[model samples]
Target: MEVKVTSSTILPSPTSHHSDIPLTIFDRFAANIHIYVIYAFTPPTPSNADLISALSKTLVYFPTLTANLSTDCHGRPCVSVGGPHEDRGALVVEATVLSKLEDHLPLTPSPDLRLLHPDAENPKHLLQVQLNRFQCGGLVIGLTSHHRVADGRSMCAFTIAWGKILRGVPIDPLPFYDQPWLKPRNPPLVQFDHWGSEFIHLSPQSNEFIITRTDVDPSEITNLLLHFSPDFITKLKAQTNKLSTDKHTTFETLLGYLWRKMTIARQLDDEECTTLSVSVNGRRRLQPTVPPEFFGNLVLNAYPKAKAKALIEGGAATAAGIVREGLRFIGEDYFQSFIDFGEVYGDRDLVPCFEKDGNVLSPKIEVDGWLGLGFDEVNFGGGGKLCAFLPTWVPFEGLLIFSPSLSQSGGVDVFVSLLEKHAVTMREISHSLD
Candidate 1:
């Protein structure tokens, strides 16, 4: 359904949930991160004032939505989560608002991407919405969520449930929040292999600088995820073997191509190092395998590398082959080794391969039925027409996302964002499609 792009409304602060202690998984997740976003729309016919009130009641139905912060096992700061029943966690909603829909900002990159500051006196996050008031007075919504509590896929599920409650329909597929995958290993697998060092905090003496800066023309930094056809994917799986052949499917092949492209985009000297990494879910791979539904931070980082000079001189297919090899090395044994590192290091810092001056690229392939699971089904009082899964931060120097192309072509939506200097080079490489 086409959603009008402009309209306005005023949403007041939600009445606090009636609880004192931490309660459910939602409370725990929301407590750790101090950010979230809301994008919603009203019906074209405009629901009666009573209907709006009825729709808003869903907020209070799930008490876990509102939680309070407490401590954890160690003296370190942590969230005291509430039980599934209600009332037992930390709930700190930083930003919430309702307004008319208007012009949409492009999906490209931006220099002024929102920033999060723990020291900000007031909440640092921003909740913005542009409403399109239709002649019939209906509405369409768009939203962006911070990457702290949930990913785009999880947020989509939440939005759908909210809509179901607003429309007074049965909560179909009820919210599934099984996050057992991120738990510590049963016997505590421990090792230090390829992931021996990853994501290190800067030391005062280190010559490297750690800074995150956005570039100009927010739209210029488009996040793109190149997807291979199903036939291609099937063939790739057959041709590439993680155990021996230095070949990997879409993720590895694409990343290899991107690493070369990004290096060119950034114009790094031939001698400089280049890094490519992606997030691996540690759930099913964890020792004894956690429940599929379990959902906390069940992710591990993997980087397959190649030198700048090596990639640029090598053609795309050749470079891609190198990437495939790197990824093939990351089979089950590699994952198990990674778990060992986590068990040994726990939350301690590990030095990452991407040095301060290093040029890096990260590309991700979207799994099926991800954000689309319940996007259209979401409704508040007015109900929503159009909605988007927005990610506030790229985290790395450049991020490429591959999502199901929302349009009928079934092509995957590709989102790309990177530093301005690299934008030009990436644009050229993007045009060199296979």
Candidate 2:
């Protein structure tokens, strides 16, 4: 299959926002990262011109995404909103793919799949989109948004708004972009001891704490899309609750189950410390809860650790309990303390260390839950609902994303990326779930 780039253009915001908006602590960390979301639709694809037109109008409310990324005198990242003639706009590309849309179903990370979205590292455009028209008359909408400007929820807001505009419908729960809502205390105080360990920052002792991009050979890794129907989730939840007196949430049960299975598959040392890092949305967890429509990064990582032997032997209940305990650390006070911690140490370069070589450096896994994100309802005019949704392959091993499946069958899709050998075992574990 071949993809040909047909046209490239810029779509500026319909209305001007602030001249310069300073990024929050959460935004600074993901300054160089870009989040990709691909949506596939059936034939009689929506008009590229119509989609672009709708996007232009949608930018009026989400102008921050159209702004260019810049650093202030303090060397901190900021969004620079340009004037009428400053050429501040998103990069829009139209391409033609010679393969059928179904051919790429359950997408994986590869050079071919990479062609679906804009360059991940490109800083010139805060938002980039690729409109791919397949030979089978199917449409694939690829979106790449700077992670510093918005989190997954924020991105969903943008797409939902664009879809509303295309369908000539009113957008509800309008977006809010004020950053002062999360301002740090006058005298920043650190309340959390584990903040330093979870976030990567500049250390006086060494530069190793700074996060950097690493490449992995696709052949050495395996990416799988596993589905868990609602029935299966209910059964798993029952099993977990039966093991422990406490009732386990579906998220905790699923995460615990996967962690246990992955550990067993890897066959790690019994005494080795294994950690699972779960992403927590802090929007509603904060004091005076942030607005549902607030656009930006409001997430924190919850790390739950246990010995491999204990985790495997304790079964799903123990693992799920550990996860529940980890989540307890993220509350109103914790989020406020985190913001203060960032203010005091915002200048430092904090990075996350992941396994680069074939060997596992640390026994760690990151699970990002994308459930209840409304990814399937994004319609781009003409009643075109998202048929499939998945992130292109990420090189990071042991990173799992739980997303809502597009089939609307009350199921969940677990996108797992692991070592080739471990992936083989994961497939077997998933098959056994049936």
Model 2, 1-434: lDDT tens digits are 58889999988765554477777777764435677768888877679999999998999888888887777677766787766544368889999998888887655545467687766545367798999998877898888887878888889888989999988898887898876657899898788863345564445755655434444565676667888998888888888898898998888888888888888777789999888878889887987888879988888778899999999889889989999999887888888887897788777655533312232323778788988877777888665546778886666577789988776576888888788888788788863542
* Candidate 2 global TM-score: 0.91
Worst 10 residues of 2 by lDDT: 353-362
How high is the CA lDDT of each candidate model? Answer: 0.43, 0.78
In the range 299-320, model 1's lDDT, one tens digit per residue, is 4445556667877786555666
Clashing pairs in 2: 109-393, 200-350, 200-351, 201-349, 201-350, 201-351, 202-348, 202-349, 211-351
